[model samples]
Target: MRFTFKCYATKHPEQTVIFTLLLSIFLLAYQLRIYEVPYFRMIGLKDFEQFESAVWLVVITMGTVGFGDIVPVTIFGRMITMVASLWGAFIFTLVLISFGSRFNLSTKQKQAMHQLVSQHKAARLIISAYRLYKLKRSKEGMGSNKSVLSESDKGISSLMRRLKEMAKDFKDERPKRRRVKNSKSQLI
Candidate 1:
């Protein structure tokens, strides 16, 4: 489901725009539901201005700004406004996510990035291997203490564990052989 939505948002920008517009329409309807003539009249707006007020309310409330230019007089209208504010926040989030999802690297760019990451992992593996070698030499120099593991031994253990995990993702960069010898010594 996440993959599908990512594809939808990144591939079809037009559809995202249409989806936002639909949400706005729904928000407008919700706003107009409770804000009748009396509600608008309290804000000194003429009854015909209800539609415009609803539009403004949707815009401001969706932005989470709460401009206070328009206030609902009736309790029902206020409650509806609060509910619409919450819905506005939700709709705003979806719209932002749809837009943000559009930013993505191209196929070639992603390949380059993966290659860089692989190289970094390989370099870290080499460093860990060198550190482990040094720690072993130090332990051997300390007269092979078999009684209790020293701090250097613990450090080597932790380093070995991390190296094991890092090695998992390191792909063999060497090319595969076209033919291989079987146990009988004949290429099969």
Candidate 2:
């Protein structure tokens, strides 16, 4: 377990997250001077007593919220806040990229998934077309029930619409399949 964590920590995502935490803590230590501001002193935040208020300030600053109820007073403290803001944004972006990369399928996996989807779409199109044809033939033979015929017309329209959409999906998939096959053949 420790070994796994060590390897994972070496990756960009984990490093950025850990760096963000460390940086935030460092900034918070630097901003400790801000509690001496008259406003904070009046609120009894001085002397690090019940320091959740300080934590809130650091977190809000890092998040770029800066709610103004609490703020860094000294020049160094303000500078720390600025650094936290930029670092927070940068870390968050890296974390997002990490998540995106984690979920990304390999090219071969994507190709296989697309092929399966294309086959399914083609099968659905064929089934819908067959159903529409059967409905038309039945309607012509059993022309007695007008309500049933009207319902069949609606069913036929719906099936035709579905077939058209599936056909389009199948057609759109052909180019992508060709590209995947070409790439695979080239690799071999």
Stretches off by above 4 angstroms in model 2 are 1-12, 31-56, 67-69, 143-154, 180-188
lDDT of 1 by residue, 17-135 (tens): 56865667566646564556655557676742646666776567666798887656667666767776787777767767767766865555555566677678789889989998988
Model 2, 1-188: lDDT tens digits are 97776577666666756676766656575466453455556766664344565667667766668788766665666776777778767766766777677788767997989889888988888888899899889989976898998898898899888888888888999999888878888878
Clashes, model 2: 0
For model 1, the superposed segments whose C-alpha errors exceed 4 Å read 1-54, 60-94, 144-149, 169-188
RMSD of 1: 10.2
Q: Could you tell me the lDDT of residue 41 within candidate 2?
A: 66
Q: List the candidates' TM-scores in order.
A: 0.51, 0.68
Which candidate should be chosen as best, given TM-score against the real structure? 2
- Model 1 TM-score (2 dp): 0.51
Q: Candidate 1: what lDDT?
A: 0.67
Q: Give lDDT: candidate 1, residue 15.
A: 84
CA lDDT of 7 in candidate 2? 71
In candidate 1, what residue range of length 10 has the lowest lDDT sum? 174-183
